[model samples]
Target: MAPPTSSVELATLGHRIRHQRLSAGMTLDELGARVGVAGSHLSLIENGKREPRLSLLQQIAEATGTDVTDLLSPEPPNRRAALEIELDAAQSSTVFRRLGLAPVRVTKGMTDETLETVLGLNRELQRREREAIATPEEARRANTELRLAMRRRNNYLPDIEALAEKQLRAAGHTTGALTHRTVSIMAEQLGFELIYVNDLPHSARSVTDIENGRIYLPPASIPGGHGLRSMALQAMAHRLLGHQPPTDYAEFLRQRLEINYYAACCLQPEHAAVAFLQQAKKERNLAVEDFRDAFGVTHEAAAMRMTNLLTEHLGIRLHFMRVSGSGAITRVYENDDLPLPADVTGSIEGQVACRRFLGRSAFEEQNRTTEHYQYTDTPAGTFWCSAQTGTTSDGEFSVTVGVPFDDARWFRGRETAKRVTSTCPDESCCRKPDSEALARWHGRAWPSARVHMQMFSPLPSGEFPGVDDSEVYAFLDRHAEQ
Candidate 1:
């Protein structure tokens, strides 16, 4: 009879059969005689190289004085067999295949000590591979450190702001909205020609060709009207800021944040943006949408820019958050002592916001056309918030800007009568279902979670964490020829 496709199960069965035969005090030849097979063929069966027929198995079991089930059990007969089985599995793994080495065949002559040594080496190899990968805990710790730094400075970076101001002045942009032409001129001032192409590397939003003094972007306009300009400016910011290739994920994150900040500063130049916001404050109409319109930027960008400038120039302590439809805090910045939901690692990015917080409640608002306002009483104090909903390819999100109740009078949404109380960080506030509902549904429901593969994956390999270097280089070569 033909053998079933070979696997660990067959190996385990062979070990059990060998063990039972020995326990019955029968030599291979003696067992084979009773089973009506050659000792060589019986040895092959005992070595997991052949499958025995059911009738043959019954005869072998009868000869060995054991049941057929005992001969087919999943467990190995002893410690030696278990080690051999584990070694076989390790050799069959992807990591073993990746080494481009021949599999080590286990033999009766191989000692247990040798098997243990080989297994130890394989385990160490796997440990090193895992160590090289960027773990979620490492990323969280890095983010926590960066967020603390941002909070210390009230989310403002004076040097980056000054650098942007110098470039904007050189581009001759001392006016209303920063035009695309001015962005182009800024690139020109840095000796970079703005070249749009459809074949830019998929991993990169824009690739700067330092050798050829060119910045390549997508031919199609980005979702937000100012995205092209922002990408171009951010690419130039890297060169202007004298950034080097990041050595680690933390450095990569810091570089990304700096470049984005530089772009925001350029988009909403300090002098003009501050003047518009001051006038809005004077009129007691400090609204994010009006700020967004005055600057021709996205709502999130306008709100984040407010975080940078409001505390430094306007004497206002505020908070900004971008929450997803599922209520996860995707982005946040604050110095208002507003108690935000965070994990033990002090990472807030993926934590769910309280259902009563404006960031989450805004999604339930009936009026989709206008901003939603609310006053939330929290452990820290009562705070007023203004949030507006926006949708992208990913899904809907809320961009919120808020302040303490004392400072709420300066904003347009303070008069809103809508209010709620949040006792979050205490899971009962939003995370935990009510007791009555839990009684009905506890242990009775199953959910298939939507897994985010990227969350489990290590940061992409290369000097730049997520950028494809080969693709980028090939793209540059293709465009450089033209």
Candidate 2:
């Protein structure tokens, strides 16, 4: 199998090493002599034909009087250092000559304090320059930009996670389930009020009355000390982040996702989750149920936490899914660079996924279920996935978590070895039936139809049949005032 990495990156490293060697006035033979490697092998390294071991790279760097970091770092060593370098070089330009300024020189022994000072000065000047022509994003544009940003970022936001941790710490959040104390802390700290009612109109999970400084939720929102912590934390995040009323649907969706991520951070702190994953990863014993029990969260919640933390901490790529009882995908998150069979609109929601997949089979289950590990081999690669089928306030749903075969090494039950071939774009995988099987059973089986065929529409959409946006909006407006 190909390495679970990029050839381009490997090629880039080789080129960087070659460039450094030439700059040091060393031929392949000379560098190989210092590194104690063959000239032919060194040539391969210089030509991007082979990867060098760490010890060899160290020797080569030492031979060239350069640090190993100078050769291996894909980006600048540090942001402040890069800025200082730029700032120092700018003083040598013709523009600086016109200003009668002398060029600055950077030394190897430059202290972080000096670099920070340069960065501070640089940012201040840039801020001042922008102040004269400052333009803030309007709500609609802000939302659109935010959505694109999330897509580009694949929703793995470390900065937001860090801020959420700070907020959680300030709110006195501990390592367990969230409680009334969380709500009380937000109300006291943010000067907000929480009110519960029998039903939240418009089927909204929670609504905020910004003018009244009140947040409203349904009584059933939190079933236990465990539930609705995400909701409460999300509501708190909006206020904490100073997010204003959404100007457009994009903004609204972005704000919702942001707060939800903040809520997850509060529930499953990053450091703790990373530590847990590292341990599980080393043992190859990770399971959503185990995470849920360990973190005191639901199956779905645990699945989401794993997806968010794995990439950042363990370098494990994964895919997540939320499917309804009717084989419709409600939500998806993927960073594995694999193609998911989405609808014609380039969306998975409200679209029929592979019927043969475990998530789709979940609809027929009456009780909560977890599928045995299954593998999907497509043109892209072989992927292994497991799913937990569950129910929510609305109806039955399933959460499937997937990782490429290479990543399976870090998770539990990777040895299940249940392999399945999935060629997603083609219908033959699930849609086509064998002629002999049809001949054997088509007329032989006599199952009574419970519902009249005429009563069922040929095309059914979304989770619920009759729900409309305008109806939801009307209900929300009425509930907002209350």
Q: What lDDT would each prediction earn against the true structure?
A: 0.87, 0.68
Candidate 1 achieves a global lDDT of: 0.87
lDDT of 2 by residue, 1-482 (tens): 12213444454556667767877998888888888999899878754468778888889889888877777765433454355445654444333455465555556587767766765665565444333321222222334455346556655788778987787677887576556677568566777777776656554666666776777666745556465566666777888778876533444567777888888887788877778778887888878878887777888888988877887777888888888886767777777855567533355455566876667765665555555577778768988888877766888788999888888876776887667777776767776667888888887888976673633332222222223556556755776665
lDDT by residue for model 1 (384-471), tens? 9999998888999999999999999999978999999998878888889999999999999999999989787866656776788889
All-Cα superposition RMSD per candidate: 18.9, 14.8
Candidate 1: give the clashing pairs: none
Candidate 2: deviation at residue 57, Å?
A: 41
Using TM-score as the measure, which candidate wins?
1
The candidate 2 region of ten consecutive residues with least summed lDDT is 131-140
Assess every candidate by TM-score: 0.72, 0.59
Number of backbone collisions per candidate, in order?
A: 0, 0
* TM-score of decoy 2: 0.59
